[model samples]
Target: MMNDIAKMQELWQEMSSWMTTYMKSFYSPEAAKTAKSHLEIKSAKTIFFDDAQIVDGIILKEKHTWKVVKNCENLAKHLNLNEHDSLLAKMIGLFHDVGRFYQFTVYRTFNDALSENHAKLGLKVIKDLPFMAKLDEEDLATLKFAIGNHNAKEIAPTENQRHLAFAKLIRDADKIDIYRVLKPFLGPTDGTGCSPDFVDLFVAGKQCDYTKMRTQDDRKLVRLMWVYDVYFAWSLKQIVEQNYIEDIINNLVQDEKMMQGITRLRNYIQEKLQTKDIWQG
Candidate 1:
């Protein structure tokens, strides 16, 4: 048993050495400046496509992944992030929903309550990938934290500013694309009004608990409440410029309280749009 354990440890060290040497040659010093051409990004894309192929009728979700990556690139550019940071941001977007493919294939549902939390599943997938070993320790941690929190109600508390910043970036990028994905599904509620608790949350400018969604109107209100959670002015601008807010509002069963929430949201959006986004990172 001791000899077998010694052999296993030796093999593991050899594999780690070979991986280190391979990655040093695979990634150039300038790789971050050309993130799209980076081998790890290519590997991530390959994993995404392979996973996507397992689930048959989710073309929309596949397309949503591409758009979310683009949104992340554009948002990074808007923030004037350096090349290394930009690459990290783009990587976060590319892998943010990596678990969704597996979730849908196995569970046949996108609902986290019905299936599993895609973000947490995504972290497991990421950690298992060999390409992730090429990333610097800090970069790898940031990537995990950002992707882990992408679908979460709120980002988990952290003092690591870089992790928090990248998390916010991925969240905004994901939400921006989500509005487009959900566009076709927006319509009048099924005559069942919004739940009283959900309405109270909306009026208070708070995000609704998605699990508590009891009606179609509750779903619509939840999306509207996402605007309050949006962290960046640039993201808010994209949402408003695309008329996503207006479209949802048009479909909602607008009681006086709903309208009050809408008014507050609109006011907040206008103010956010006028404010310049200065990157402290």
Candidate 2:
């Protein structure tokens, strides 16, 4: 039998491989020249930050996911049985940001300021493809259910362990990557020294300049903090086992308030490690 694991890998590869090709072929050379000639704006940023941003975000999301996959594989081996569930965990990590490609290609914006949820966009990408057809309904359900809900209020109802597992993989992998990347500020970042009131309002936790309570960019930062907010022993274990807390604390820059926030989360992590982290995770 091919088994679920092989099938899951095939599905993930199918999406990733197509995504790579699409990013290249999306705007053909003639289209690029003609489009540029048509709408070239002198004031517009060269290489729209949005474009690089999503690309980098997806790239980072994938990189972080690979770390989770490695850890999950090691975890599965330690738990000592083999099947596709571990691979499923890895696949979840990979697709959690799979929508960014389309969101960028279609909207030229990842900010949601451009108006579309990446999660929703991701589902569109999954549904349009030959690869999505390959998975059985169970795997397909896990794909959307996990990816869509990765940023959702609940990863899944507690009863759906298989669905829940995929979500957890995305959460851990995404946070681990973010913390490792953003944690290292030598001093207070000072809100990049300067421009918009948006940063000021955000760090202060006041109403933002933007209409949405939180923008896509803001949500990314908020989600980073929410990593500390995760519940579940396996998730907690993954946090410590992955060293996300250390990554954040070691590079912390303090605003008195931000410092307090970091301090609190650090204590919470310590408690989870000492009192609650004994499981196989």
Candidate 3:
């Protein structure tokens, strides 16, 4: 894992240098400077701090960010959003996890209860740093709202529908890719210090009732609940096509109860996908 992370960092540096040169060719010198400064801060503050904890957590997170960005692009086009909206969606995905770097660096765990609310921490980074200051007022608010609320259980009531919509996009995109991250890591392994009990709970026969989730293994239930948070049918379609749920289930110990629970969740998603009134309304 350390070797993989080192390679990823090296690739990131190469990509950053290439991008800096590319930006200078067409971007105004001032814009180029700001962009380069942003990259420098990302490297110095988040990516290259020489901490094992930060580096380890960020590899999955950084890949997740890129996946979300691509997912948002496809979602925007399918939803027929304007070019500006599409770009905004991509940007929100890119910047959503800025807080996680700080959280992991300080607390060494992704658990918000143990550390801090990563979303709020991310909001502070965006507002306090010049990294996101280049955005105009409208773009800035949308980015802030989307990133700030991406992890919330429900979208906050908003007078601005755009904020809710963009937030929904990021939430769906983020959750969709998370299945990829969880598949390999959540299971039990020998001598790796992974929790076998957690893997059992994950592969257990019933949909984990969140209220009943007291053990660390039960926490995997939250990933299952993400299906409820999904907004767009397009995102749901992608989830289905990727067979994310099936892949997850395949790794688990299945029984009648587990099958039933999985069926209920899958059916709910299918119902949501077919319910045009709910989406249009």
* TM-score per candidate: 0.80, 0.62, 0.70
Q: Give the TM-score of candidate 3.
A: 0.70
Q: Write the per-residue lDDT of candidate 1 for residues 62-149, one digit (tens) a residue.
A: 5677688789989999999976677667677777887776677667678999989999888876677665776668988998999988
Per-candidate local distance difference test? 0.76, 0.54, 0.63
Q: Which candidate number maximizes TM-score?
A: 1
Local accuracy of candidate 3 as per-residue lDDT tens digits, 1-281: 46544543454345434333322232233333443333432223122344544544655565566788788788787777765666678777776776776677668888787789899998876576543554567878988899999987677888887887889888888877877777675553222321344334434433333444454334444566566667887787777787766655554545565566577777787788886422210
Taking the candidates one at a time, how many backbone clashes does each contain?
0, 0, 2
TM-score of 2: 0.62
Question: TM-score of model 1 relative to the true fold?
Answer: 0.80
Provide the lDDT at 53 for model 3.
48
Position 231, candidate 1: lDDT: 86
Model 2, C-alpha of 196: deviation from truth (Å): 19
lDDT of 3: 0.63
Q: If candidate 1 were superposed on the true structure by all CA atoms, what would the RMSD be?
A: 10.5
Model 3 residue-pair collision total: 2
Error of 2 at 98 (Å): 1.5
Candidate 3: give the clashing pairs.
Answer: 205-257, 205-258
